[model samples]
Target: MEGYLDIIIRCVSVYFFMLIALRIFGKQELSQLNTADVILILLISNSVQNAMVGTDSSLVGGLIAAFILFLINYIIKKWLMKSTFFGSLIEQKPEILIRNGRSDFKMLSKLGINSDELSEAMREHGVEHIKDVKLAMMEIDGNISIVTTDQNQFKETHYKRKHNHKNLQGEN
Candidate 1:
């Protein structure tokens, strides 16, 4: 019973520490990682492990840590709803990287995304080329949103071409 109680205390302590650390780190959306950001993230887990589980080095310590981590996460999420600053911290700002088929190379460099990677992301979203894109934004959650420049025009042109073809075929 004593060991169990000790484990619970250690877990709760670690949980609060992690919560505070995360809050202090500010809301860095996963997608906006620079080289330094990636390194800090990799180190964070190992650094916090000892605090989360007591020196006992047992599975029980690990389980308690996990439980505390979950509870803290839940609490933080609830708190975010009540605080606008927390919401903004947790959510990142959307960055416009492309507008009117032009790539904002400056923004791309700042975000550490190369032209090739951007091209690939665009391709995954069914954009064959940059010129076809009207707006491309890097969302706070690390997602890329691409809006085609002339969707309505493209659709209208396609229908016209198809109708003309059908008419020609009928005449033949």
Candidate 2:
């Protein structure tokens, strides 16, 4: 029981460290990670294992860390919902990567994003060329939000097609 308490304390400390680190690191979207960001996360997790578990191969430390992580995440989420400045601090602001089928070279360069990377993001979304993209934004969470000129019409047509199919099914 005494040993368990010590493990809990260690785990809590590690949990706080992770929370503060994440807070300081700000927000990153799933699409925008460079090589350095991925490596740092892996290394941070490795280092925390020693600090949280010490020499003991026990589950107590792991459980404590998990609980604290969940709690901190909940709190931060609530805070984000209430405050725009806090949201910006944690989630970052979205950047316009393309407008009117033209790339914003200045923003792209500032973010260390090259043309190839931007093209790849567009490719993932089934865009064959930049000309088809009317507006492309690098969202705060690092996701790419693309707006094609024909998307609205495409959505309307798709909705009508679905409605017609549902009516046919009903008649059957």
Candidate 3:
């Protein structure tokens, strides 16, 4: 019984440690899992298994540890959903990359996103130029969203600007 209790404590400790580690590392890690990420996760699970089960190695002991982990995870999720402060601590806010044809260079630099990458995202949304974008946001989930005016609407605005400029030149 004492050994089982120790296993429970160790499992909980490991769980919290991992949660904090992931939080500090940033939510981007969870958004994309490349080969290295997969390898790291595999190694982490293998390394922590011993700490969780300890010397017990019994089926019941392993099951107990897993059950406790699941329960704690459920509770944490519930708490996060109910508390805005906790949610903000664990979750990232969306970032605006471009707005009304203007790019936020500071935000792009802070997020480690280069113009080429930003252009790629724009291209993915069928936008050929940054000037054509009305708004581009990097969502909290690490996906880029682009908003653009309709082609016909943009054309009308462009024509109106050209006509207005010609009239001003004629008056001058």
Per-residue lDDT of model 3, residues 89-144, tens digit only: 87778889999899999998876667767776666566788888898887766666
What tens digits encode model 2's per-residue C-alpha lDDT throughout 51-159? 8767777576567656766776788789989998887666667789899899999987766666766776666555778988898886665556677766643421110
On TM-score, the leading prediction is 3
For model 2, give the 10-residue run with minimal summed lDDT: 156-165
Question: Where does candidate 3 have its weakest 10-residue lDDT segment?
Answer: 156-165
| TM-score of each model, in listed order | 0.61, 0.63, 0.78
* Selected candidate, larger TM-score, 1 vs 3: 3
How do these models rank on TM-score, best leading? 3, 2, 1
The positional error of residue 129 in candidate 1, measured at the CA in angstroms, is: 3.2
lDDT of 1 by residue, 1-172 (tens): 6766777777677666655675454333343455565787679777867665657678876776678678777887898789888877654567899999999999877766677667766665667889988988876555566788755533211100111112211010
- 2 or 3, which is superior by TM-score? 3
Residue clash pairs of candidate 1: none
Give me candidate 3's TM-score against the actual structure. 0.78
